[model samples]
Target: MSTVPKREEVAKEFQWELEHIFESEKAWDQEYDQVKALIPQLAAFQGKLSSAAEVNKCFELEDTLSISLERLYVYANMRLHQNMANTKYQALSEKARKINVSASEALSFITPEILALTNDELDALINNEQLKKYRHSLEEMKRSKAHILTQAEEALMAQVSNISSSPNNIFSMLNNADMKFPKVKNEKGVEVELTHGTYIQFLESKNREVRQEAFKAVYATYGSLKNTLGATFSANVNKNLFYAKARKYDSVLDMYLYGDNVPTSVYTNLIDTIHENLPLMYRYMELRKKLLGVDELHMYDLFAPLVDEFDMNITYDQAKSIVEESLQPLGEQYLSVLKEGLNSGWIDVYENEGKRSGAYSWGAYGTHPYVLLNHNDNLNSMFTLTHEMGHALHSYHSDEAQNYRDAQYPIFLAEVASTLNEALLMDYLLKKSTDPKEKLYLLTYYADQFRTTVFRQTMFAEFEKIVHERTEQGESLTPEDLSSIYYDLNVLYYGKGVKVDEDIAMEWARIPHFYTSFYVYKYATGFSAATSFSKQILDEGEPAVERYLGFLKSGGSDYPIEILKRAGVDMSSPEPIQQAMSVFEDLISQMEELVK
Candidate 1:
């Protein structure tokens, strides 16, 4: 058995390398002082920005200051996130955040003021030799001229950024820090706490009773706080509505789809398509019910292992090789970067007490992308490794290829790279495994991916759309209202086969995405896009590989859907979603064959 160190011991053992950021804390402090001194200078360019020289000077100075401030902000926040209980780091992080916000407010007038200038004036400035350096930035600013608010309004928005983020912050605190769950007994008579972090593990438990009990216990806690959660959800919906109105958007949906240059049809289409596919999902549930030999399958039994649990245990070293081999289709340049990342400590690869739960890849421009994972040496963790590395490699390529302004891709396309990596890894494993049970497990696992990504996320998207539309129509949602809407959707998708418990009605309270305003739909869209891309890569080989790699390298230089289109996936069409559902159908057929 692996050693379980004390919480304090784990915190002491986990230290991130900040040398890439600054030589020392003293140096970071010095930089912070420099940023503070520069903030006032930024405020001096408030109104007089008509001249080309002035505009050019402002852009150069602001870019330098913003990049420096971001480095400090990212480093400090990452340090604090690494260990939330550390008061010193927490204080330092808060200070950095405030400093960055102040800097943003100080520089806020540049865009709006620039936007206020007539097209002729902007053209004159752009034509000037000095401002020529920022031609792309100027052009991009002009693209959003219609949406740019006045200088005063922009300043107001910047000042309120922290307050605007409060809903997500409160949700995080409630879900991760404050919430508690009852101890649940497994089939082996082992007691496990049903915390948010451990809930997934319990769902995957072999014992049906354990999974059901854990799900009930966890959702029951969420159900109790339904009122508070409703308020939080309302606050978030209001925030989105506020921004959409302020930006002159027809609706919040328009504002969200505006950023990605996609139409509302894309969102509605996923919902419509998935609604049509509900019977397929129900069929899968029926199969699961029969396989488990249960009278009824509860929502908890959704994640139970389909076969005897196989320990596809892999060491960190083995994981690296597996990911590299699986991703070989992307070519040597990609593999070389992965190798560098493995050697350069870009990954914090193990679970420890007090470390932030979950896996994610994060970094600032001009730094190596870093991945944080709670590696458990199982197939799930192995897939997570590849998934996060896909994000890191995407960031690496983008940061190398695009300018700082365009390097950060939107959330719409972010999942494409990550999920594509997962699809690739699944294909690799399925081909390598010949054992019937192992193959059955792998196929079932892939089917679950479809269920979670496509079915569950679409269900969430529909829930969000309904809640937002109701709020837009001047209706208020009580906790009961939210529960009823969520529960009905669950019944629609799960059908009459599975037992939809009353506690499952309150599941909406526990989901963080309800606060993100139509964000979950991307997971469904992304999976569809990934499925299409993965198939092309496997079928067409090198040419398709080139396009796929280029997609990763493109970043935010263009719209995400357009970028994927260039890479060989047309998300505008419903074909990809249909293809993903077909993959699910094939999996069901295989599982049926295996069970027979």
Candidate 2:
């Protein structure tokens, strides 16, 4: 039996250095205590914001307290992610969560108190020289003044903040800690434990029987808990709906986009444009079917190898080097920081028992970013390496260029740099490969990215819109309803040449992104924006690199749309999506030509 190693069994270097954030549990506890003490000090500034000096003082103290709280929260949660089954870290994480709620309740009064001021007073603060560092924040507060609740109401919501987040936490605990899958036979007929980290590996297996068995086993596990998963997801949707209504937003999507100031049309236009271009998706699926020579292309075949004998097995070291070389277009300083980050204690690089399943780049503002990766020696894992480092470097650059008040980039723009890294990596490999078969494989590889990131994620986005709207209209989604919605989308997206298997209906039960509602859409939009950015950088060289970096460094100082506009891609317009679709079409044409 093949099984995952325990956290202690994994080597130290592969683990992220949590010591950099908190030297010891003692250190973490001290900082947690310090942040709690400062929350009361923050609350004391409740009724004193008339003068510029007082406002500036209050803002500075709030920044200190907030950053400290962020550090505490990040450290504790990351510790838990190492092994969710670890009871000690779980308690530490919950302790961090409670303090975060307390800190939130204490600080919630600031926004309402600021909103309570007269228009002239607000305008004055926006232009106040003493508060020059916070001009953008003040402007944002003014923009959101209409939704800002009274102090008492904000405090009440803050008190219930942790309760509202219950669904996501509950799902996380169940999915990561408690969920178990029986071992399935591998391609070699050896039994291996089915895990979240290995599920994709099995799906991508060249052996069809192995793929089908893994798929059935994994979903059967999720299917057993379908009702529980459905209720959890419904609770999450209600949480969003409740907050949206409380904030006086017309819809949950509007509430989410309001932070980045993105319009609903941008969201709708993406779906509309993709719907118009889905024939390209059909064309790609047909090509896939022809290449694989399978009588029917089942859902499990989506990630199967398209071309024979073009294996790109990459070790983590090779993945790092290849990613670094691929990003050379971004210039030396970018490479320098990237290399340092890769070598430094900034990433937790392998999977252990009960570690978080997927990959993400995260860190507190002042610290270097950390990437969590469940890496395998395969082409897909290499892409994930570049993808996640893109996020880490984006965070690094933003932290370097902006103050803590503006350092974090908006979610709307978060995926741009990451996908751009992927674009560059694909471009580099295509250029380097001398073998025609390898070249064809790489082309199909990138084409599949479009299929997955753009088309597939758009489908997920549409599903969210449907489910959320249904819930908003007083329909609670049962397990059947969720599966039906997901199944219909599979038919729509892959119906032409693929089998659209029944087990795929339960696929949503395992999707972690649904927990972060409306987030899947950004993957689609970001792929488009990054395609445009990559094209510009390759064609225009230094000038484009400068603009792209400027966009990254702009952080959350401006609206995401405006930042992208200035950086040369206008996401509000459908041109980027259309351009991305055109690129996808070109890849298909190239593949058709090559096969001939």
Candidate 3:
């Protein structure tokens, strides 16, 4: 029997240098104490933020306290994820959470206080040299004055912010912690333990029997909890509605979109365009069915590998060199920084017992971005490395160029960097491959990216919009309602080429992204934008690279749509999405020709 190795058993080189953040547990504790002391100092200037000097003092102190709190929080959370069962780190994590809440409560008065001032008063205050640095922050606050509530209401809202999150928290606990899937036999007829991590591997197995069995086993567990899961999701939707209504937004979608200044038309346009172009998705599905030679393709068959895996296993070191070469269009400075990070202890490269299962690039303002990857020696893992390094490089560029206040980019713009990296890597691989089978596989993989990222996520986005609209229109969302809505969507999107299985309806119950309404659309949009950006960078070279870097360095200073516009892609219009669809269609045309 094979078991996950402990963190101690892993070589030190593969492990991340957490000591770079704080040096030791003693140092982390000292910073935690220092953060606690600063929180009170932050609250001292609360009632006196009217004058420019007072505002500057408040901003400085708040910035200091917030950055410190984030450093402490990231350190604790990363440590906890490294070994969740370790009680020492668990306690440290809990302490960090408590301090974060305290910091939130302490700074709660600041926003309402800023909103209390007249626009003219704010304009005059921001003109002072000392306070000019916060002009963007101040202007953002000023823009939201209409949505900002009274101080009393804001305080009440802040007090219950943690409570509002209970539904998502409860759902997470139920899904990640309490949920258990029954063991399913592998292709060799050996029963293996089923888990969230292993379920994807099962779905991707070459054996049809294994895929179908794992699919049934996992959903059966969720099917049993349908009512409870439905309740939690309903509560979360209503929670979104509560906030939307309170904030005076027209709908929950508007409320969510308002944060990044994305137009409602962008969301509606994606659905409209996708509806018009879904036949392309159907064509891809038909090709899949024909290639696999299945009588009827079930939903479980979607993730099976298109071509056999042979000599495609890429070691981590090989992946680094390939990624570095693939990203050469981004220029020398970008490559230099990325190479340094790849060589240094900037990534926790392999998974250990209790380590986080997925990949992410994370760090605080004062530190180099760090990545956590559970790498397996496969093409998929190779792409995951480039995807995450995409995020890390974006963070690195932003941190190097912007001040701490402006370093954090919004989630709306976050995925573009990552997906663009994927496009570059895919293009590089296609150019380098000579084997017909390998080229077919790479083209199939690229087509699948569109099928999944663009087509599938739009389906999810449409489902979210419908459910939120229903709830907003005084309809209660039940388990049957959610399942039926989701099932109908599958039929509509997948068309008549495939059978929409009954168990697939219960899929909505298992999707965690639904809890965050209107968020999935960004994945679709980001992929489209990234496709356009990658094409330009490949064709236009240095000039395109400069534009892309400028957009990354801009951070949160501008709205997401405006930022993309500066990067040579206007997301508000449908041109980018249209071009992306054309690219997908062209790939399908190329694949059909090659395979024939």
Candidate 4:
């Protein structure tokens, strides 16, 4: 209810020990220097990449350089995120970016050079015992041989990587640094600062007036800059279109999906399935209107708690314990590592002034993964803890099982572990509660996951696909165009029950994910896959647990779909998604029954 604490006020143990990556600033600088020196050495192996020994040598150099470069970049970026106003970390972050660009420029020739080899030459080279370890990595490169341009062109692309990211950088600057929201009165009738953190809290306020005021205030700021935001977003779409065109891909969607071997069907399937289940969302919205006793449910009214009297206040320590208990089916091996990370300062557990908003699990190879959190001591924050831990454990297992070169998992498979943890936690909580009101609250929260993560993300994916296709077709997407499309999607997705507010049309201007097209759909599919797998783990027990663990350990060793298949969820088929929807339906039905 009050302001978030400053970073210094948080106790020592609550913060992550970034020193695990490097002892001090000097040590970080030493690694930074090593990365700068090592990157240029890739030039020596550029033209001489034909031989098996030469190819193997390039991989070895790249492996070491990449590991060092990632650590330096992540360390700097994490420091900057902790306190965005810090000029020292800001410079270090920029320095890391320069090193990254240098590394990309130096290594640009490796792909084209590898593509230059004849099929026979490449096959024989990968067949060698010394080069066998890199076969999967090389094969992946070879798969993109058709898109691999000349060495000169590749170098040009790499050199301009930073320039290409200007739109996202501008958006971040405008959204986080420059933008300010008007102060709004909370439920207590006290004027409070509206922020990215406080905005969500206000939306969850029991007072509808506070929720509506905060929502309108935040959007008003974003709406004022719609043209500028739209221009930046349009530039990003054009940037993706440029790369897709240059690569001779069918569309920007194809180019983005190509990297992970994902088919366009997956994106389409998610949107289609969600649309088919629109009535369920409509039913939920109707229930929201009834519970809030509002004549018409505005967009802001959707976030107010249905069971206002049932506060599931949970502390960080309790969240960790709940996560441990909920994840018991995952076995002791998983729990031990999770507990160690929690106790060993692998988590920055509370929000503070100048700290990054939201949460994520991130780390570079050769270091354990870390979690960033803005703990609000609420039910949502508790669930977020388990969700991020899912990602942390996934990284931990992958790093342990695979070499540095192979440990990095793709984003497609990344959400499964996190969402699965949420599902397990939900099940654990539901089973533990016998109180009808408590059960209704828990079920409502679980059902909201489907609406927010699955359906809303699918809406975003649809919007992204349409905008990119229009961009590719030489259509200039203006602010009006963006808003009109978003509003139409809102109408379709929200159905007739909920009023599609006009100001909500400008919501597109504030979504940072739009800068990266086709990325949000993974949240939908990942949630669906996790839901299906969580049910399997609960129903089938050990076998399901083993398979899911194997998928986590598999990491980037295989394509995302194949890894999921081994884990007993075939995302390629629509069954998992349908099953996830069934879970949503069941939750809604259960909630309705309990409310009656």
Instruction: Candidate 4: give the clashing pairs.
Output: none
- Give the per-residue Cα lDDT of candidate 3 at 288: 89
- Candidate 4: minimum summed lDDT over ten consecutive residues — where? 587-596
- Per-model TM-score, in order, reads 0.85, 0.81, 0.89, 0.85
Q: In order, what lDDT does every prediction score?
A: 0.84, 0.90, 0.89, 0.89
Ten residues in sequence with the least summed lDDT for candidate 1: 6-15
lDDT of 3 by residue, 10-110 (tens): 89988889888989989988988888888888767878989988888888988898889889999999999898888998999999999999999989888
Across 1-596, the per-residue lDDT of candidate 1 in tens digits comes to 64754344654223345677776888889999998988888776779899876776777788778888888887787777667778888998999989988987888778778888999988887678887656656777776777778778887988988899999999989888988888999778888666777889888888777888888898888887888888988899889889888988888888888867788888988888888778889889988998888998888888887777776888877888988899888778778998887767677766655668898888888888888877787888889989998899999999898877778888889988888899889889888888998898898889988999899999999998898889889998888998999999999999999999888998888887777777889989999988888888888988988998889888887778788889888888787788778778878888888888
Better model by TM-score: candidate 1 vs candidate 3 = 3
Ranking by lDDT: 2, 3, 4, 1
List ranges where model 4 is wrong by over 4 Å. 1-44, 69-108, 151-202, 209-239, 348-359, 372-377, 470-481
Segments of candidate 3 deviating more than 4 angstroms? 1-15, 18-37, 76-102, 126-129, 155-199, 213-232, 352-356, 475-481
Q: Is candidate 2 or candidate 4 better by TM-score?
A: 4
Model 3 TM = 0.89
User: On residues 498-550, what C-alpha lDDT tens digit does candidate 2 reach at each position?
Assistant: 89989999988888899888889998998999999998888899999999989
- Candidate 1 regions exceeding 4 Å error are 1-40, 74-99, 119-202, 213-247, 350-358, 474-481
In candidate 4, what are the lDDT values of residues 40-84, reduced to their tens digit? 788889789999899989999999998998999999999998888
Error of 3 at 382 (Å): 2.2
